[model samples]
Target chain A: MTGGAVADNPGRLYVNDKKAPESLRDLRKIEEALQGNLGRAREATVGIELGEGGAGSGVIVSEDGLVLTAAHVSGGVGDDLVIITADGERHDAISLGLVASTDAAMVRIKEGGPFPFVEIDADDTARLGDWVFSLGHSGGYDDARGVVVRLGRIVRVADVTIQSDCKLIGGDSGGPLFDMNGRLIGIHSRVGASLEQNMHVPIREFHRNWDKMLASEFIGEGPFAKKPEPAKAYLGVAAEAREEGGVEVTRVLEDTAAAEAGLETGDVILEIDGEEIEDMENFLEVLKGMEPGDKIELTVLRDGEDKTIEVELGER
Target chain B: MEKTRQSKSSWASARGLLTAAALGAMASVSPAQQLEGPYRLNGSAVLQAFEPLREVLQSSSAVLLDDWKSFAYGLVVSPDGYVLTKASELADRDEMAISIGASKFTDVEVLATDVEWDVALLKVDAENLTPVVWKDGEEVTIGSWVVSNGSTSRSRRRARVGIISANAREIKGSSNVVLGIVLKTEKDQIVVEDVKEDTGAAEAGLQSGDVIVEAEGKKMEKREDLLDLLGDKEPGDILKVRVDRDGEEMDFEVELMERHRVFDGPQSRNDAMSGRFSGRRENFPRVIQHDIMLSERSVGGPLLDLEGRCVGMNIARANRSETFAIPAAEVQAVLERLLEDSR
Candidate 1:
């Protein structure tokens, strides 16, 4: 199988040379890596539908028909879903559960034998600029095209999310993100600022919360689920727009996350976990996704010096 | 080779600093390390791989500045001083400056603009500008590597690399020119069923039950015929509308407005009737769509091929999936027309 090429030499899959391709041979290697993963991913990826109108993508991850998809795609736990495989094979499945904070969900085939599946790279060896491949039933499954493959490099990877440049369209929400070595690394979660800037639920996040998902224990409210106004994570810091870009910390509440993290009042916040913060609005937008107890690193400038402070978020 | 080595080392050092900073107090004794954590490598090390390409392309591009702040990027199309940028970026801004290399020129003049193609030609009274080399007549195969070159917020050249995801294509916008009035065929005659409020039709005293007879000297027997007649016309164009009400024919001169603007709400339900017909017109300039991630300020720059030849001028960040560029051939054609129009 083409997927065996990467497994044959996993050492070569690590792109330690962080430089632009200077020759055709360099590009060919990267292209081959992507194609190899695409071949493997095409078989496991399937178009998922809950009823009339709800559509997304999913990847079969286990031989016993365990599937991984976005939490938003599954909508709610124990819902009946129809999984249409790449060859147009329809299998009845049921959503097990979802981790709404990370948009990771799982489903199990109700009636099935051994299925074509991909292995998750729980090791988290994926790196920035590493060539990654994405496969999904983009624009819904067309009988002519089947699954579409897009190749791009990993842009940003955080504890809860992985960002990549692989362009994803509307029906690709629950697709799989694979590393060059054909190992499943992430699942498509949501679109970021651009099509290239896509958010994915890191496989590591799933591995950490596997027991919860397998037990069908609902962790948080998915995008489609009714919410009871859950308390949001908060940092006791007052921020305002800074003239020199980013947000300046006006005050830090006593004994709160900001105060405990040693964030000073005069520090200008520049980035939150590798994502650039342009202003107060951008800063709030980034904070909105995080939950209480989520540890984040804030890059800030204080009195002509740059410092990175770690803060454990507090509940609102 | 030396430059490549230097860049690699510099990137490695930067990555080291970033890792240390991200780890913060936890760098000395890591939590993931204490436990039997998954074998992992931080992915932040390889972000600076495009620095070399950025350095090369920055020499040929200019930062369009206004009031000491860079607003857009422009491709230096001529050695003496011509710059090509997105026409929309120049909208409503009379005072402009162009920065090439370390020098900035404030005496910039907008030579001409092609609103249909969304391109503008500007000239600066300066010399020694490095003109971009065009990849003329070259086939842009899908999946071929391309780079978007533009100036960063800190006035440094930045490069975003991605594959040519798609070829020349036309996309439709929600807004289209329309003389807002809903029509219904009654007894083989097109009659106005409703005249949208605040629309050109309403403003022109057109009312419901008004029978459309002629438009711009063309006879209208059906709704399609009227739409076909107005298809070639644009917003702000005056239309000599002839209608019959109460068995009496009256003529009204109406100026068309965009359907979305006239409705002043969501997309009109009778968009097919009142909305300006839209789709990819056959005569649109060829464009190359790439998946390069770019902000609005990064657009209007140059899209270069792997060999460092300019393939096109970045026209629009169309949507999430694509950023479009007007091909070099089309840019050259527009440049010639603009030059002729100016002369």
Candidate 2:
């Protein structure tokens, strides 16, 4: 901002048909509102600690310094984290706990201070083509960054994910997507590697997991609750997803299962436990429920090459 | 060998005291005080620091320089009167002359230079020249107090103190590599941030990442070190110094380079308005007997500007918000013999 003066080129619209002047003005109002909201949201990123989490973004949701950021940030368990502001003032923070299924975590600052919080819609019904903006971190190492807003229409609303046209990158994950009226509909999560695609976890998932979190000692389930029954059909190898591209084979653990069935890096796993995987989410959820000693057949696309191996799981 | 060894050891001790005093002085300043003036360099310092460099910066035959004196940012390397400046500063000018004491006699000759770091050495006709002083391991660490000696009326020197937030980053827009310490004191510290390679700094084994804590036993926390050293010097000279490396004291000899004029030809007239932004003077740091001195002289001469500051030295600026200075550690090599006899 030039001396805090908002750039005069605001209130842009992206609708399909011709609209009335009043409607045109309304869209402008929405854009500026989102910008203001975005500016406020970025305050968290700047003051967040560094190396605290492997990677994730979040927002404040309570008055007592409780913030809702990605579980991945807290999950890293042993990194030093600090957040900085746009003007570069830094603050140290600690992670409380996380609810993995919905990708949300609760954090609190040691000291109390005023913070910004976004309101969530209770009924869970935001129409398609509605004005939605994702305020997320972007660019190098993605810390102390401001929100890069990519406005788009909502296409699909599922039990867990909300698909949208807004273009997002790695740093956008765990952030929020809001309705122009200031209601939180979903989070700004992952985006497809090839297309201008982006996805998010609807606010309902967060709400659904709220009880489970309150009842349990921590939010998310403990490691490897059960190796899915369908996992037996494919090779049992651990994998992590990439933001710009396809799933990568991070570890083979022990090939006893996959070695009897072979797999390697750059190998794309299409199915796990026989629950055909569409992308990163399908695979992650499958592993979250896997049991030790589970024997599974693996299918892989290694390099331009394709192969498979059956292997039993081992203790981490 | 015994004499040289004893001199070196004494130089080392003096450098150590300078470093300690600087840190102590810096620690006493209040945080609120740092947010305001004294900590904030008056705009004149930026101009004064470059006065010397403007001479050599306008020379450099390796690049084409049209009417060298027209460019900004050259520093004086020798008292016989040699000018040293960045190669890019003279990229367009092929022919240049050294102007001693701003004298009408302008035909000084270009001498040996290191093209890699944009440092060109020149020689002018002058006698009994004065130089900036520097000691081994004498650096202006990240948070040291500094004065930008600029050409201004009423206020001759502008000072700012900052911490050395980062070092070893590459300079933008030029192939020239800078390896020296940086000073951090305020919000607007991003204008320049390095000392050139193989110059007085790089030669004294001062690597880019070393943080300078003091100079000449004058605590960096206080503003006395540099001010006290500048009291003695002609335009085309070098400064010796002491630097703090990884908490250890060391010695270096940095030559004071000159600032050059940026526009001097027909094409320059079209863009003359922008050249005015660089101003008229600046400071270049150099090492002394056991201290670091920051000097700015015009056309490589000792004539002080209207504000009582040495003019025409170039200070390296890094960003829209920060700047750093180069100390003269090697340019004083010619005077090293003089110091040896004096001691």
Top candidate on TM-score is 1
Give lDDT tens digits, candidate 2, residues B27-109: 24322111111111122222234333333222211111235433433444344444455433443345664333333234545
Instruction: Note the chain A TM-score of all models in turn.
Output: 0.67, 0.54
lDDT tens readout by residue for model 2, A130-160: 4566555432122211334455456445555
TM-score, structure 2 vs. true: 0.32
Second chain TM-score for model 1: 0.65
Q: Which candidate is the best by lDDT?
A: 1
Q: How much is A103 displaced in model 1, in angstroms?
A: 4.4
- Scored by CA lDDT, what does every candidate get? 0.68, 0.39
- Give candidate 2 misplaced runs (Cα > 4 Å): A1-29, A43-47, A50-55, A76-92, A140-145, A214-316, B1-343
**DockQ of each candidate's interface versus the true one?**
0.04, 0.01
- State the lDDT of candidate 1 residue by residue for B165-243, as single tens digits: 5436544333246788888999999999998887788889999999999998888988888877666666678889999
How close is every model to the real structure, measured as TM-score? 0.58, 0.32
What's model 1's TM-score? 0.58
